[model samples]
Target: MDARGWDERYGQTELVWSSGPNATVAEQVSGLKPGTALDLGAGEGRNALWLAEQGWTVTAVDFSRVAMEKALAAADRRGIALEAVVADVTTYEPDRSYDLVLLAYLQLTWDQLGPVLRTAAAAVAPGGTFLLVSHDLTNLAEGVGGPQDPAVLQTPEQVAGALGGLRVETAERISRPVEKDGETRHAIDTLVRAAAP
Candidate 1:
């Protein structure tokens, strides 16, 4: 969806996503030492806020103004600070490097995804990490929740290829149980963590 479409959706509801961070984000980052972080497509700023709470200086970027506002308010309510930037990830350029760059479920077409992934990788400082978690392409047939469009779905291999210069720490498809309509089902996800050498 375009930025305006996302903004309209966020306007329709008080919260589009859960107030908590994504499960993969919490699991992967909890053990790491806090540092500068950039959260691309930071929908409601849940992950960004959580990183800030963990003592990381976070920059939350999203294309939707509505989402950015909500994210900022969430930070304020939590008595934490976060930098909010409203811009398309495909075009937005980072001014400096970060210790950690997060791209949580920022699904896009192959044409768009490549550029954003490259940009995100370029923003990672030496020895820093560039982590991505997204709905796997197989999720269409095996998973319960997530966008149904195949154009936006990606695989771990595809993401790894996009991040050319980074050393891949983890690149695999994993399953997670998702609760929907009082039923539990497994959702396939692509998790990639690449470190800049």
Candidate 2:
């Protein structure tokens, strides 16, 4: 989707996404002490705000103004400081690198995602980590709760393919289940954790 599309979605009353960090993100990184962190494509800044509460200096970037506003409000309510940026993640260029860079559930087609991942991975400080999660390509057939568009879902191999030069610590497909319309639906996700060389 383009910036205008995202802006429209976020303009609606309720947040499209939840107000908590992704389950996979919290499970994977909660043990680590917070530091400088960046949340790319941070719609509503849930993860970014959580990071700030954990003591990280957080930068949250998204294309939607309404989302940024809500994210700022959430941070204010929590008594945490969060820097919200109104910019497309596809083209955002950070002033400095971060200790942890998060790209959770950013469903983008290859044409849009390649350069962004490159820039995002490059924005990780040396010895720092770059973590990414997305709807698995197989999720179109096996998963739930994500865009049905096939072009946007990517596989672990695809993620590892684009994020070259980093040592991949973990890359795999994960299963998730959700109840929708009173029915249980299974979903798959691609998870990647890499360290900057």
Candidate 3:
């Protein structure tokens, strides 16, 4: 979906995603000390806000103005400060590097994702980390939630390969349990964490 489509969807609901940060993001970042961070495709700023609370100076970027507004409001309510910018990830060029560059559930086809991932990786400072989480390609067959379009889903290897010179720290497919109608099922996700040399 484009920014307008996302905006419409966000407008129809109070919150499109959970208020809390992604489990993978929280777990992976827990070991790292606070530093400057950049969150790409930051929808509602859940992860960005969480990072801010952890003492990281965060810049949240997203294409949807509506979503950014909601994120700003949420940040205000939490007494956390963050830089929120409305820009498409494909076209955005960071002015400076960050200690952490995060991309969560920013699903796109391999061809479309390559440039974005490279741009994100390029924004990472030396020894900094680039973390990404997205629906795995196998999610359509083995998962519960997330985009069903195969074109948008990617494998951990594909994500890792896009990071030109980053050292691969972790790249794997993981299953996450989701509850619906009192039943629990698993969703397949690709998690990739790389570091700049």
TM-score of each: 0.98, 0.95, 0.98
lDDT of predicted model 1: 0.94
Residues 1-197 of candidate 2 have per-residue lDDT tens digits of 67777778887766787888888988877876688999999998878988898899999999888889989999999999999999988889999999899998887889989999998888988888899988998888767778899989888988887776888899999987788999987789999999888
Q: lDDT value for candidate 2?
A: 0.88
Q: RMSD of model 3, in Å?
A: 0.8
Q: Which window of 10 residues has the lowest lDDT sum in candidate 1? A: 13-22
Please write out the lDDT profile of model 3 over residues 75-192, one tens digit for every residue. 9999999899999988899999999999999977778789999999999999899999889999999788899789999998888888999999999999988997799989999999
Off by over 4 Å in 3: none
**Candidate ordering by lDDT (highest first):** 1, 3, 2
lDDT score, residue 183, model 2? 93
Better of 2 and 3 by lDDT: 3
Mark the 10 consecutive residues where model 3 has the least summed lDDT.
106-115
Off by over 4 Å in 2: none
Q: Which of candidates 1 and 2 is the stronger one according to lDDT?
A: 1
